[model samples]
Target: MGTVNTVYWIFTIGLAILLLTAIIVLLFLWKNQGQLREENRKLRMSYDEIEKKYTGVHAEQLRYKLNPHLFRNALNAIQSHAYQSYYALDKLSGVLDYILYDTDGRLVTVKEEIEFARNFIEINRLKTSPLFDIRIKNKINEADPRCHQAVIAPLSFINPIENAFKHADLQSDNAFISVSFSFENDSWFVLQVANKTNDLPPSLNTRGGLGNDIYLDRLSSVYGVEGYSCKESINNGIFITELRIKIS
Candidate 1:
């Protein structure tokens, strides 16, 4: 009877030891899993940050590529008026200064952008003869509290203006290009550019549309897809491009 009792006690003690070992193993596994999950989450966050930076850099690269084209056009305009007028050279100088210094920045004041557009249109006007009617109507009330302090992506309007000048029928009798800017509903900034198209080959009409695409890409990168909207239409030889941004 004594031997049986001893054996039963030993078996019970062994069983208890096995149960304790199993609990310890489970606890260690749970702790390790939690640590791994934390590390994985941190890694995902790091990846996201890196991706955002890369995308910003890529957008900047695309933006800079446009500078050379703009500079060339500005230089050509200055040369067109060489020895005849210095007004264009002066205007070109200001445009170059803005392009070189201010435009490298991600944003500029609405006033500055409007001024730049005006200067750009002036340069284009100088390039064309008096027969071409280039008109700019700026209805943005500088007195309006929103117009004074609002900021926008630099060179946003210049691309479409450039396209308008490039494809417009400047030599025709009724050649006209119009640019208008206004603040709508006190929350949205609207820009509209329309030009009469020339009777060009089908290929040329489609070829110069890439400038608008680049402009749209830059807008999307800066303001996001939901912050701005763009529309383009062609009717009766008139091509109109409109952009509206939620400024407030």
Candidate 2:
């Protein structure tokens, strides 16, 4: 009877030891899982930060490439036109000064943009009315003014506007550059510019230079291709560029 009691006691002790070991192993696994989850969360956050930085860098690069060219072109035009019989050079200098000094990635009010466009037209008028005729026509729905709200990317018009002045001839009174604005969908806006070019160099369509490729790259970088639309087509000896942007 004493031997049997001892054996039973030993078996009970061993069973308890095994049960404790199992509990300890389970606890270790749970702790490891928690640690893994925390590490994953931290990694995701790091990746997101890196992605944002990269996007900013890319946007800067795009702006950098275009800005220098814009400044140089504006200055050159001023210098070349200074001796000409027109007050446009003085006006151009003022417009360029305002455009270049403005901070990048800043949004200007719609009313401000309208003023810019008007100043732009006056400056062009000095060069010769035919090369670029800029007209701003608006049909505001006062019932819901927000729909006709005006907004534009900083220095956005410099490229296309300059192109109209430089590459296209405004020698003909009929050759007028027109920029019109309209609001739709109660939250979106459209800007359409029709430039009448008497003779567009075939090189304008070529890939490498200041052609569609360069324009497309700049546009994509600024607004993301999904945010804007640009289409170019020649009709009746005029090159028209139409851009539609979402205001919201």
Model 2, residue 181: distance off in Å is: 2.2
Residue 215 in candidate 2, Cα distance off native in Å? 3.5
lDDT for 144 in candidate 2 is 52
Show the colliding residue pairs in model 1: none
- For each candidate in turn, give its C-alpha RMSD to the true structure in angstroms: 17.9, 17.2
Cα-lDDT of candidate 2: 0.60
- TM-score for each candidate, following the candidate numbering: 0.70, 0.57
Please give the lDDT score at residue 173 for candidate 1.
90
Give candidate 1's total backbone clashes: 0
Q: Each model's number of backbone clashes?
A: 0, 3
Over the stretch 3-58, how does candidate 1's per-residue lDDT look in tens digits? 99999999999999999999999999999999999998996685565345435544
Model 1 lDDT, residue 49, Cα: 57
Residues 1-248 of candidate 2: C-alpha lDDT, one tens digit per residue: 99999999999999999999999999999999999999989966855553453354343533423445544655555566665525666566656655666435455445455456666766555556334455667555445545323444554554555566665656777777776666777656666666777764434455125544666676667667677787667787777766766564
RMSD in Å for model 1 = 17.9
lDDT of each: 0.75, 0.60
